[model samples]
Target: MIENLWKNIKKKEFSSIYLLYGSEAFLINETKQLVIQEAVDLDEEDFNLSSYDLEETAIEVALEDAETIPFLGERKVVLLHNPFFLTSEKTKSKVEHNVKKLEAYIKEPSPYTILVFVGNYEKLDERKKITKELKKNASILEAKKLTETELKNWMRQRASYNRVEMDEAALETMLQLAGTNLFLLTSEVDKMALYVQDSKLITKEIVEELVAKSLEQNIFSLVDKIITRKIDEALRIYYDLLKQNEEPLKILAIITNQFRLIYQVKGLAKTGYGQQQIASVLKVHPFRVKLAAGQAQKFTEEQLMKCISLFAEADYQMKTGGLPKNMIIEMILFQLNHDLRK
Candidate 1:
């Protein structure tokens, strides 16, 4: 939900000091731009729009201005590009020396002045006292990456807002191809949207043509087949991917997940874990859990137990560099296929 902060952004409620720090610079920039657009009238730079790179300057210019009145001209926005100020103990302490100087100003930041701090640091010590003060005194919004579901939502929203309609399969395909990288997905989705302008409904076929195919090659269907004891279909898909250059370990990973799901679902169902609980236990989306749980019926409790050992062996082999990754995966598929047919 926090990943969708841009959707919840309200320009009017802009805070005095904003800490925009994250790997997802898109959110940081998008939110900052939205706030700036709302706060400043576009007529001219009535408020001094100053951007500072902390590597170059102390907080004196940025934090000190907190006391000064808006020049007769208008409000001044001091943009601190890098809060290396809060970076290390030495740098952070040097910066913290002015907590009072900043605190005095933060208490009543100039109405016309907006201080923006962008740390972009890899880590934030939320436990530190000064960190607590900065976080508490300012609007500390961390830009988090989107999860799979949230990424799906993002792709749809981006297409719809841009007047492009991507169907469910297409969106799913896009998500698969895009992986979890929001920044890359955002750009790729936009590019595809512009290309498919002629079509209101972007179909899976169109997605296949327009966007890149997913890495696993939709091996989820194979996951479904193997779990349902549809050995024939499962092997068919497995062989298809292998012939298409799909690595064995990759396929093994997906199949291992399948049996693990069966064992999980059966265990949970026996415990009355219900769909929701099973989904949570498996860390899979609920709809997917529901399907896997239904498919779990094909696996006897004994079969599930036995296969767990097989999967364990495969995982060990893969992790220990015990076998070529593909052979390790092929062995898993062969075991699952043999057991299913038996």
Candidate 2:
């Protein structure tokens, strides 16, 4: 886990070669920063720190720098970014990387240099020998998105790190409001931590008061209200979104997307697919799948299809100027609520 790796890095237990690869930019960036902060002093950054874009440069070039002695410092930190060769994806750059040199370097890395490979890729080419060798030799961190449980734990840890207590309801509310983006979540938690510093506790009310909802989250809540048959609350959220200058067509698109997800999740669940399986198949976060699953329970497949049809009609009317965009959404909401009541 990244937490274990972070703890080790904090203790100054350095690894000679580090591999950080995944789709999550926040995790990759955070781990890289933590390594650099713990490995070298500010004064040594000029001579001891180096970065190379592997797409434009050869791997051996970085290896040569890694082998070189650090000037005015005991250790050197070399950041190797965009190691596209590690993954199956091909890059536009024609720079030829000498994989043999990388393989040999991995086998016997320079003790005086901290070599970090930063591949912002979802997965590496596991069939490649160099990838296998590096995995065997280096400290690895696959900085992927965290699961719901992992996210909650990480938020708790972040609050604790800031000397604040985040209650369970607050955590859930934060997740609901902010979605699963780690960068936004970190900012919200830090801001709330500072807000409740005097009390040293974050309650659900504090979270509701502080965390700003994204457009997508607002759409989700609007859908949630509709599902619960709370037309007033749903309209209120829609009005609030309009006051914030959100386009009605954009809102309609997201509402359509959410209903589509609910339809897909419902169908998949009926076929015995688990939440993670559905998430993987749909290429969405598991938490989103979980929420869609709950919303799916309140809808039959046919009802979801009808909701999607209404959204489609709304989209057409908004684009064709048949009705005012705001009225189109309002009408769709009312139509959906009326259908649910029947």
Candidate 3:
């Protein structure tokens, strides 16, 4: 997709029709708008511009509207957003009726009319017959979630493109702390870029102080204590996070997710699965999974199961409001670590 995206964006070779679907609606919509603005002008909108919401209108009505020629122009453009209306079961009759009509029209679509479809936030089922037909007949771009490492690498490229310089460590720290919320991450990076206008290099201090849950130090400290079975030290770190307004449920959730990954690595290593298979299943980089799998071999399955169940109980208690949240978690840390040590 990356290689194709590069070649597809060159205007001279661009496809006239496009179906853009994805979770990242903001970026997708921007790309759609750019295509439209380049295709027509504001003064020509009366003859050229038409937009519809699928929830409100039928496919036949949109097709009829699109096929109508301008009273006074050379070209027409139809913009359909959330055309899921075209695919509804209740509207299936109408959709089939219109799709055939559309295919007929598409075969000899207007030299003056450009049809563009947008489903900004949700995806159209690519596995469906209609989706395949659309793909074969027109251009399609599916914007989806970037992998963790891809997002991290992208941050560096994005910062460079935005005329910002970020230290490699600071960039990596943001990736670990922030996961993959591109909108928020881009905003934070942009703000830091502007703040460091004179200095030119965005430092770790700037990022740590500004970004929420800058976990470079705190997480390392927490991970260290947990790994070494230092219950008291881990408790202090956990409580520090709590006092700073981190939710108890979120902490339990993150640790639980981490443990599950470790569990998978352990199981795969025991069975002699290679690093690539483990990474794909875990959705982590092969090297990281390999390193974790090697480290996982050092811990007994008993320790892994003990940590998992402890977190699970902590989660259950928090969700049910069954006990004093902090105390329950604090006790869990001690009992589990104490058991591991003995």
Candidate 4:
């Protein structure tokens, strides 16, 4: 796990070569910073740290830097960024890279240098000789997206790091409000920790009061309130969105998408598909799938299908010359509320 990697870094356990590749930018950047902090001191950073853009600079240039002796420092850190050549991606750079130099350097890496390759790729071409050689020789770290449980645990750990305590329900509410965006959620967590300073415990009330909901989250809440027969509150949220100048048709489209997700998750669950599995099938984030699954449980398939049909009609009415967009959405919500009661 990443925690183990951090622990090792703290103990000064250094790897000569590290290949960090992934789709998630946050985890990849964070891991890189951690390694740099451990490998190079503040004073030595000027002379000891070197960064190269593989697109602009040849691979041989970075490898040469890696092989050079450190200047006034015990160790050096060479950062090779955007190694697109490792994958099957067509090279857009005019500069030519010597793959043989890279392979040779990997075979005999500098004892005094920490050579790090930052590949912001989902998956590298495994068939390449250089890719295979690097994997065979380097310590690899994958920066993949986290699952729902992992995301929640990350929130708890981050809260603990900031000396704040978050209850489980509070954490869940925060996640719902922020969705699965780690960067946005991290920023929110920092603000929340400061909001409850000295008090130190984050409550569901604190989350509701302070955490800003994304538009998607607000729509989810509106749908939840409508499904549970809180018609007045649901209408209030919709009105507030209109007050903020959000387009009525865009709002309706998102609501339609949400309903579609609920229907899909419900069907997948019936077939013994787990939340993560369903997310994979739908090509969406697992956190979204998990939230939709919860909402799906409150709705029967017939009711969900009816809501979808209502959404389709509302969309058409908005696009064509039927009612005003706001009125159409309002009428749809009112009708949905009436149907739910039946």
Candidate 5:
């Protein structure tokens, strides 16, 4: 697992060749930074650290650098970025790579150098000999996006790393408020951890107070309020969004998206699809599917379809200047509230 590999790296357990591949750019970047930070000193970076874009640079060039002795340091760190040849996808670059040289290097990598291949592609061409060789010989990390459970655990780990304790409610609220981006979550967690340093505890209240809500998250809250028959609260959220200069049509778009997800989640659940399966089919985060499932329980298919249709009409009116955009969204909110109340 990536976590174990990270632990090993932190302990200064160096590997000759490392393969970091996957769609999650954050994890891949994090692993690269961690390796670089641990492998080389600040002063030695000038001579010991090298990064080559495989799309533009030939494989033999990077390999030769990797084979070169470290300058004024015991170890050398080489980063190979965008190794597109490892994947089946063809790049626009006409630079031809020497795959045989890379394959040979993988077999007998330089012990004094740390060769890191950063493949941002989602998947490698597994059938290729170079990929197979790296898999067999190198320390590998497939930095795919974590699932909901993994995300929660990662949050807890981050908090713990900062010597703070986060309650379950705080964790869920953090996810809801911050969304699933690791970079944002990491920042928020560090901020909150510092805030609760005295008590060393992060509660839901603290999270709500400090975490900045994205526009989509505000729309989600607006929908939640509407579902619970709290039109006043929903309108307040809409007004707050407008105060922040959010475009009416953009807010409407997210509202429409939230209802559509609820509708889809409701329908999928009826047909025996679990949250993860539904997330896969819809190409969204599983945590989003979970939230939508809860909201779906309060909504019937007809009600959701009606809500969607109202947003569609509001969208058309807003675009054609039939009504003021703010009034259009307000009217849609009232209409949805009135319909849901029935």
Candidate 6:
């Protein structure tokens, strides 16, 4: 975890080589920024900090740069970005990398240099000799997506850092309102911190009043309203969405997505999967799983399945039929409400 890595960096513990590979852009960028802040002095950055895109230059050239001594500092940081050679994905870079050169450098790296290989890829080709050698020798940081527990812990820590206190309810509401996107959550946290700067306590009311819901989230709310038989409120939300110039087809697509998620959640829950486990299995954010689980509780398995089929049909008709999109969606919502009332 980056927190563990940060602990090492805090104690001035340095690694000769760091292989950071991940799909999470926020985590990768934050890791790189923190490393630079900890390792290189601002005044000597021009001379001590070096970055290369492997798509433009070869790995051997970056290795050569890593071998050099720092100009004005005790150590230099070399950032090798987009090392597509590590992944199985084919690259359009005209430059040819010497994997042998990189393998050799890994054997005996410079003590005064922090050689960081940054690949914006999910996984490295494990069968490759060069990939194996780098993993064996360097400090590897995989910025995988965080689980529900991990994200909450992160939020707690972030709240402490920002000098604000967020209650459990407020945090949960924030997660649902912003979804489980780290980048979006981070931005919302900053805004909430400023809003609660005086009182320093982020309450549920504050969260609900301040956090802006994504369109998908609003659709989820619409579903909740429908399930609770508040059809008037649900239609109000739908009208407000239309007022924002949101396409009815787009809205229908999201509604279909919600029904499908609820159906999936119901099936998974029947098999005794908890929210976090279901989230992992479904490759969705934990916050989303939690919300889906709640919605799933309001319907029988049969009802959820019927909802999915109805929306699937709506999706097909919207794409092919000449019917107005608003009417199609209204019919779907009305029929869903009617079905549940039975």
Best by TM-score: 2
- Pairs with backbone N, CA or C atoms under 3 Å apart (clashes), candidate 4: none
Q: Where does candidate 2 stray beyond 4 Å?
A: none
For residues 1-342, could you state the per-residue lDDT of candidate 1 as single tens digits? Answer: 343444444525556777788666777777677666765666545555667776576666677665476655455567777666465534533333444566566666777677887766656766655566777887766776555577778888888877888788887777655555667777877877788888756667766786654544356667666666676686777677877887776667766676677778888899878887776677665656665677777778898888878877887888888667766665676678778677
* lDDT of model 4, residue 94: 90
Residue 297 miss distance in model 5 (angstroms): 1.0
Model 6 TM-score is 0.89
lDDT of 4 by residue, 58-112 (tens): 9888888888999877899999999998898887689888899888888888899
Scored against the true structure, residue 13 in model 1 reaches a CA lDDT of 57
- Candidate 4: deviation at residue 31, Å? 0.9
lDDT of model 5, residue 299: 85
Can you give the lDDT of residue 243 in candidate 3? Answer: 84
TM-score of 4: 0.86
Model 6 residue 155 lDDT score: 79
How would you encode candidate 2's per-residue C-alpha lDDT over 174-281 as one tens digit per residue? 999999999999999999999998999999999999999999999999999999999999999999999999988888899899999999999999999999999999
| Top lDDT model | 2
Clashing pairs in 5: none
lDDT of 6 by residue, 1-342 (tens): 677887898777989999998877788888888889999989999999999998998888888889998889899999999988888998778998888878888999998999988987988999899889989998888988876677777777788889998899988888778877788888888888899999998899998999999999899999999999888889999999999999998998888888888888889889888887888888887778878888888899889888888988888888897788888888888888899999
Q: What's the lDDT for residue 325 in model 4?
A: 81
Candidates' lDDT values, in order?
0.68, 0.93, 0.68, 0.90, 0.91, 0.87
lDDT per residue for candidate 3 within 149-226, as digits (tens), equals: 666676777677668788878887776555456777777787777777788787788887777754433554565576
